[model samples]
Target: MSTHLNDGSLTPLYQQLMEEIKVGILNNEYVPGEKILSEMELSELYHVSRITVRRAIEELCTEGYLVKQQGKGTFVNPRKMSRKIEQIGDVMGFSEACRACGMVPGAKVLTVQRCPVRADEKRFFSLDSEENVLYLQRVRTADGEPIMIENSFFPYNAFKSLNPNELNDASLFKYLKNTFGRTPTSTSQTTLEIVRASTELATYLDIITGDPLFYMNAYFLDQNKEPLLIGRQYIVGSRFVFNF
Candidate 1:
């Protein structure tokens, strides 16, 4: 760490400290919610002034990388949020991914409601007058670990008598195949802007609010190219990472 910093480098000493700490967190050397060393300890450890350490910590806190308790020292921020990007046109369900990864898939159904489709959804799904929609919200987990929060709207009649609780450990695609003899052969997904985790979402996922998170909107289609499911997923960046 010392080799990366130069006294004559255009960067300030505090900035160097912040960059090193940031890298440490990303590399998992410093974990989220883990207390950092105190000012005096950091000063001694880095051979820097206490003021420099304080400034460095303050900048990190303001940038949402660290949290400071009134009486306690600062702590590394919680895990980075994540999303898994499937190959284009590949069809799989949330539970299948968890199962394949050797993790048990779990879900907590938050709400079930019959509602008219929103305007944006209408255009996206090309809704017909005959199609009735049901809104489903569930927090998906793996091996009892919170991973994603799903907000979806499906055609009610296609999944008639479906209870959200019964979806545990069952892939949505598999259910479609078994119950309705339908399956999604392909899908289109779009990732939106990165955003800070919300209080409710963070609480559900056991992370601090304002943590980094990824947002995704996906459209699933059946073998016949008919829309099967349209949904949005809020992924926990820390729990999962993807290459594409």
Candidate 2:
């Protein structure tokens, strides 16, 4: 560690300290919720001033890489969340991804209604604007912690028989295949954007308005290449690092 941190290097000593501590935390050298060494101890360990160590810790806290308790020193954040579903896109639903990460997954169905497609949705589905569709608004959780808001739109005929109550704690992917004999064979397109959370999204995601969140729009196709559904998800960024 001393060999990598240089006094004459372009990077400030505090920045160097931040990087060093971040690596330790990310590598589990300092496990989540574990208190890091005190500033004086870090100063002695790194052969730097206490102020430098304090500054590093402060920056890490502000970045969501660490958290500080008033009288408890600083601790590694437990919410270094990661979800990687595929190479280019997270084709798997949120529940599956969370389970793969060793976290219990759950969902709360917020809204279920059959409604007419809006103009943009009609264009994407290649349907008449007056045609109705099945829409669902859901909140996804990992280990019972709310994580994202999922808004999905599907053609009515394909899922007309689906019971909204069945989705309270269910996986949409599994339900579709088991009940409708529908399987997603391919992803036609997906878009990613970094945006501040809207009020509604922030409320469901348990984040403050204007906080950074990931906005994703995905289009899935069935075996015959027929459009299956379109979904938009707002994922909180501070608690997650999207793997795919």
Candidate 3:
């Protein structure tokens, strides 16, 4: 539905206006923790009385969809995760990192399964071209808020014997060691970048497209110093900070 308020509808003008603003919130036209247009601005745009706009916004605030910060205007209530700035050297799973920062960590798996290894994946794992790998893509959260998006590839054989339930709500590295007897001896390689979020990324991180993100790429190494898994992550820009 369009964001414009409909005056001809039987619904009260304030209710109609509320739906439009709510749609903007749901559509990321108003990002979490970002201020919405002032009452005057909204009233002018919707061609509604200022009293109608004010009542609609107040209802939104009472419904917990928005917050009014003193002197700062109304903001879409933030549901966010913030990882501290001291985690880069640990090279740990996000679950572990979140714990270290005193936040509850969770994962929402987008995809998880075994597949034929891509050429680059084979090179990373030093596998023959015929080998296959296990792939996992998840949105990581801290305290119920999306923190980062991760895509990882691991040698399928290393995980074939384990049940998915064993890893679902736990740290992947910890689960690998405890359930499958495989543990990375170290992590190698480091490449970091800041990139503009794409539409897909914006959906995952609950941010607007074109927002900046933090990117990191690394490889988990086996005891023999061979790559065990390849990990690439896009972290929400304002939600995470890493030590240099």
List TM-score per model, in order: 0.69, 0.92, 0.63
Clashing pairs in 1: 80-237, 80-238, 81-236, 81-237, 81-238, 82-236, 82-237
lDDT digits (tens) for residues 140-193 of candidate 3: 888888888988888888666656565556787787777766666666775779
Query: Which regions of candidate 3 deviate over 4 angstroms?
Result: 1-89
Worst 10 residues of 3 by lDDT: 80-89
Tell me the deviation in Å of residue 125 in model 3.
Answer: 1.4
Candidate 2 Cα errors over 4 Å, as ranges: 1-4, 85-90
TM-score quality measure for candidate 1: 0.69
Full ranking by lDDT: 2, 3, 1
Which is the winner by TM-score between candidate 1 and candidate 3? 1
Task: State the lDDT of candidate 2 residue by residue for 1-244, as single tens digits.
Answer: 4524688989999999999988877676777888888888888888888888889999999988899888878888895677863333336667787877788888899998999888767876787876888999989888888888888899876677778788987888888888888866567888788999888788888889999988888888766777888888888888777775
For model 1 the local lDDT of residue 85 reads 61
Question: What clash pairs does model 2 have?
Answer: none
TM-score of 3: 0.63
RMSD (Å) of each candidate, 1 decimal: 4.4, 2.0, 11.8
Can you tell me which runs of candidate 1 are displaced by over 4 Å? 1-4, 70-72, 86-105, 118-126, 141-149, 168-186, 194-215, 222-226, 234-243
Candidate rank order under TM-score: 2, 1, 3
Candidate 2's displacement at residue 41, Å, is 1.6
> Which candidate tops TM-score?
2
Q: Tell me the whole-model lDDT of each prediction, alpha carbons only.
A: 0.76, 0.81, 0.78
